[model samples]
Target: MGQSEATVGRWSEATIWLHWLGALLILSALMVGWSAEHLAARDDQPLLFEIHFSIGLLALAVMLARIACRFFQARPDRSQVPPLARFAASTVHLLLYLATFGVLLSGLINFLFLGPVRVFGFVTVPQLFDPEADEWLRALSWYAHVYGWWALTALVLLHAAAAFFHHFVRRDRTLRDFLPGRR
Candidate 1:
């Protein structure tokens, strides 16, 4: 949900903004997807799916930018953090990135296999993969998309819990390091 490191200075404003934007887009897609799940028998479900798909694509773009930023950015010194905690934080950060892309890619591939799904009932999604010929791959992507969502959800919760723990239990500024202008 936030940076894995506790910084001695503030993060770049762009990274901070992207972090919040990515969180909003991801959560919005999750809500829309959940609604579509519950409304499975309804006529408007496809509309929900279309909205979810659109948001997801946006999320993917934001995530890609964030990952690019990561490579060029220097992380805060972890000297103050316990080695185990630092390792765990880094692992969670990596998993969060992987799960995010995994979910998005699998969802996109699954739709391509199931297309031509209409976006907003006007624009038709092209069937890139022949569903009849790639039924097995379609099934695999479907499972990945569904299970990836669950995995991402769990990682988000863990990320948030770590932040809250730093704020409350540890009485540290680690959580504040994630806030904008909190240098």
Candidate 2:
């Protein structure tokens, strides 16, 4: 039998936690990365870069867990949403995921090209390619990483706006569905 549509629903606790954790990590990483890029070349530049990289890696891990939870858990019922809204939400979500993974992977690739990096001050990640020889690959990844962040930032803003619209304008429980304590 088909499940009944919920007038109000909630995601699993794990999903809620992972969603917020991923958002926090992504925001922190982006800020750190932007700061590291714009600062004057200083002795501490490597440390700042490593911190950004660490945050990006952690965000990637949380995102993976969130994806797994999404697959295994029951999502909040969307029966009340208009078809167009559903389509737009799904499209934005898909693009957000793509941009996030792209940014994280491209950043890793760009970093690897620069040679070994002492991640978090202890672990040494050996360089995967010669920076001088594979400058083109590095450049490509660099561009992708930077542009991916911009795309992600836009998508995130759009996502939040949609949620607020559903909550305040539409006067629905859409926003509460993802809140930590909602049921």
Candidate 3:
């Protein structure tokens, strides 16, 4: 379909682009974080760290935009899905967005507590808080960051599974709305 025409219950071009790009960054950050220790030991570790940090920040920014767009734009008609399913979908989406923001903030705080770290080059991203931050804050933020990863993974899996369920089990357009092309 052409840009001029809107697909029913589907996302706009800008929203779709932001969603996919945010997804990519989130996935990349997770991969980097998983290998952080091993990667940090290397000479290029700082470089890798900066890349991960930058992407995480980018994802955070994109998510903020996503939330704003979600509220401002009209969603595709929910009349197609059962009322319960629609409610579930809305709830899941809200949780996903909140969880995503939490993960990003945890990382940011972790870095801030670590002290001023270079983003990717000699240029440094300023710490949001002073180094040697409170012990409790440090420990809590650390756990939050660690657990955030696991939570994010589980949430994404559930979201993906539900989308597939709608596509296969429900035989609905729920999942297709996010697809690049309308069938």
> What's the ranking of the predictions by lDDT, best on top?
2, 1, 3
Best by TM-score: 2
RMSD of 3: 4.7
Location of the lowest summed lDDT over 10 successive residues in candidate 1 = 1-10
- Where in model 1 is the C-alpha error above 4 Å? 1-8, 118-123
lDDT of 3 by residue, 1-183 (tens): 122322345666667778888888899999887776565677767677787887788888988887666666655655666799779888888888878888898888788876578765566766666646477777777788888888889999999999899899989776777865553
RMSD for each model, in Å, please? 3.7, 3.4, 4.7
Better of 2 and 3 by TM-score: 2
Q: Which stretches of candidate 3 lie over 4 Å from their true place?
A: 1-8, 38-44, 181-183
* lDDT score of residue 167 within candidate 2: 93
Cand. 1 TM to true fold: 0.88
Among all windows of ten consecutive residues in candidate 3, which has the lowest summed lDDT?
Answer: 1-10
Backbone clashes (count) for model 2 = 0
Clashing pairs in 3: none
Q: After superposition, how far is residue 105 of candidate 3 from its true place, in Å?
A: 1.0
